[model samples]
Structures are given as structure tokens and as C-alpha cells.
Target: MSAAQDPGTPPRPHAMLIAQITDPHIGLQPGPATGPLDPTGSLRRALAHVRALQPAVDVLLLTGDLADSGRPQDYAEIATLLADTLPTPADGGPRVLAVPGNHDRRAPARQALAAAMPVAPDAPGDCVCLHVEHGGLHLIGLDTVVPGAAHGALAAEQLAWLQRHLTACAGAPVLIFMHHPPLISGMAAMDACGLLQGRAELGRIVAAHGGVQAIAAGHLHRAIVGQLGGAPVVVAPSSSHQLTLDLRPDAPLALRFEPPMIGLYRWTAADGIACHFSYVEAFGPSHPI
Candidate 1:
């Protein structure tokens, strides 16, 4: 794809709002009242907040780890909760886009989710292509789910498909959402379980494509920002449980009692992309950010 822009047709300024929630781990039973692992309540409240947004979010892109165990019941709960939270097409309900995490089983995801959710456009119907034009900004969902493994990988077919779609845009503003980060975070443990195998190849594809205005991810269960191929890359905070950020492996398995929060991303062609690591009014802030 030519990296040139058309000065005359000047890229139209756009403002788009996306509500991103990641690593809900929604199926796990809340830990004892004394503990902070209230996946169910946190998720419930988080969804409520998303619903109550004044302008209404144009889309809800879940970055994965939807289930605690990839269980059928867990996905069922997610489907039902989402059914209540998501808007009706008549009322201009926010478009819902989701990809599986290490904890999610694609088969169960298929069974539990309603057929209405959009699939990936270029792939077969099994893989969803969720494309939404929110305030003129395009948000594209990519699947990096690899079952029975903690790691994630984008198959060659998917990578080629992504290149094609991104190139076709011809410099149009775009955002890509996926389950795993293509680059490593500082945490060594996470790096071991993050995107696997095709790092260099993926970077080449992304760097070569100029339309990726920004890229969003989930899986790390933290709100992280870094660069991948010169585009802004964001990782959403987990809703159900927290990943202990302690870079030291000697650190205890830390899951704090903080109330759930979701990451909100605002993207525009005019001012570029801005992010808010926002929490619902009822939640507390205990992390050392």
C-alpha cells in the first residue's frame, strides 16, 4: 500500500467513542465477601455504567478472557448479561464485538453467543468480522484465539486478510482490536503467555499498512500503552480480576479487591486517539499506577 495521503480530499475529522472491557473472567463465583474477586458484581456494574453513558458508546469491544474456565455456563451468563445490557438495533444499540482469550473456548463461545454478533468480514461466518462506523471512525475486531494454550497467535491466513483489508482503506482512519498484544510488556511471566511465534512478521504487516490509526488489546488484564509499528497500542484493564503487576516472580499471586473498571478509548482523525482508564463511581482505586 502506498504510504501517501490525498491532500485534497483531506481526511475528515471524526470523533468516535468505544467502550472496551477486558478479562472479565465472568464465570468464576465471587470469592468470599472478604475478598475482591467479584467477577459477577463487577461485571454487572461495569455493564450498567456502559449502558448509562449519556451519548451512548458507539461500540463495546471485549478483548477476551470472557470466561473464567471456558465453560458453557460461563458463556451463557455472558450472553444473558450482554443481552440485557446491549441495545436493540432499533434503538441503535452499541455494536458488540468480541474475540476469545486463552480462557475462552471458541466452541462454547459459538454456542452461547447469539448469532447476531457480527463476524470477521473477510473470513468464513465462523469467525466474526465486527465493523462499526462510529462517528465516522472505523473499529475492526481481529481474532487471535488459540484454544488449549495460554498464548495467542494470528494464523497466516488471518494476517494476510488483515493486510488486505487495511491496505484497501487507503489511509482511512482505523483501529484494530485483538486479544493479545503483538509486543511484549515488561512482565516476564506475561511475555511467556502473550502473543506467540509471529512477532516480526506481524510487525512488518502492521508497519507496512498505514491505515492502522491505533491498536487495542486485552489479555494482560491491565491498562497498558506502548507502540507497535509506530501506532499507539492500548491494553484494557480486566473487569473481573486483576493481574498482579509485580515484575518479580517471587511476588505472590496477587488478586486485589478493587471494584471492576473498563477502559474507554476516544479516537478522532482531528486530534488523534486519547484514552481514559476509567472506573465506575462505585469502585475504589487501590492499584499503584
Candidate 2:
């Protein structure tokens, strides 16, 4: 049973609201296009949505693919927008945390966005693996980017470090964030290029720990819910454009101009965790039911 189910102990008074934004693909200023959609404008609208949330979120998780070409100027654009417009969390914690997508080059990403992320001494060359503790919750980030490849993989060293961290947090719920979705999405095109290796070992670690709340990821460019290592795997929608949903085994890869969106993960001692997807552009005003 969970902490909330323990009859002899008081329910833990901890809860967290996290906003996840992914695959911004913030290309250069001229025109950033993923199909017919303009990535830059889409991201601007997405951040606008985050600011409009009621009571604000506790932390913002940028799940990679930050830049289309991994260009310095593209990262600069993101930095400028985050520095100027991203809302400060209600609890006064760190503003945002991020990882690198396949599209992001390590040197540039580290030089540009590393300061905004947590740090771990054991992280391998330019790999962004780290952890953060907030409101009695543990958040772990793993770098799954494989140099010169579209698919992702976690090195054994990084996995070992992650195991150490998970072991240390045995009694507390730990949320793991990475760029690639570990499970196979029914969308064949995306799954073909998903996490390329080390998934089973990672799964075993999570299964053994038993304290992991959920695994949140991006790169599929759509919302997908599945199981990996007996834990919930959530694939968030891109903040820029979405992958055309075609479940056929031979479905051609395509992009759609669907309204970009963000993912929200809410966790409490009693409920454990729940996730929802919301559009970046408002369709209408909310009505009290």
C-alpha cells in the first residue's frame, strides 16, 4: 500500500503541479516550419498558455528537441523568451528544468541551457543527467541523446548513476524525465526511431525501485499513455507541431498543424500522479459547470 493507505500515519501533505513542454523546434528567426506550422510562433503561444494557468505551475519541464538545427541563435531565442516571459512558480522553486533532444547538439545545448538545469558530478562528457528535490518529491533527469544519431540510448555509466539515485530515494516517489519515450508507441514511424537501447535494464531498475511515480518523455510529438517497467509512461505533445496520427503499420510519417499543446502532471500523496493535455491556443472562455 501507499503512504496514504497507512492507517497509523498521517497522510503526507505534499503535492506538485508540473507543466511539460516539448519539441519546440525553435529554428532561426526567418521561418521555422514543421509542415505548415511555424515552430517559433507556436512556442510563443504555448508559453502564453503556461502563463494563463490558474494559480500557476510548480515547475516547468522542457523535455528536449529545444532547437531544430541545434543552432546557438535558436537557443538564444529560447533563453530570451524564458528569461522575459516564463512565470515564476508559486513555491519559488527553480523556474525550469530541461534535457537534450536528438536535434540538440550537446556543446551548444550545454553552453546555452545547462545553467538552467540541475547538475550531477557523475555525469559523463557533456551528458545532462541530474536530480532535483522539491516539496518532498524527487525529479530525475536522464540524457538519452546519442551523438550523430536520431535515436537515443543511455550509456551504462549514466544508468548506474541513475540506479544509485533511485536507490537513495527508495521511500519517496521519484519522477524520471528523458527525451525519448521508452515504450513503443503504436505509431510505427515514431517507434522506429525511439529509444534504441538500454530500455530493458532501465525497466528492471524502475521495477525494483517501486518508488517511481511515472516516466515522462517527449519526441513522439503527441500524447501517448503506456506502460514500461510496470510504471506509467507519458509521451507529451510537442509545443510546436504534432505528428499525424496514423496507427497503420506502414503509415507514412507526416506532420499536422493541430493546435500545439502542453502536458500537465499533478501528484499528491493520496493520488500518486495524474496527467492531462491542454491546448496552447484558447478556443473559448471557461464556463462554470
Indicate which candidate wins on lDDT: 2
Could you tell me every candidate's TM-score relative to the true structure?
A: 0.84, 0.90
- Steric clash pairs (candidate 2): none
RMSD of each: 5.5, 5.0
Per-residue lDDT of candidate 2, residues 102-123 (tens digit): 9998777777776556567766
What's the lDDT of the predicted structure labeled candidate 2? 0.80
Candidate 1: residue pairs that collide: 36-257, 119-128, 119-129, 120-128, 120-129, 121-129
lDDT of 1: 0.72
| Whole-model Cα lDDT of every candidate shown, in order | 0.72, 0.80
TM-score of 1: 0.84
Residue 147, model 2, lDDT:
78
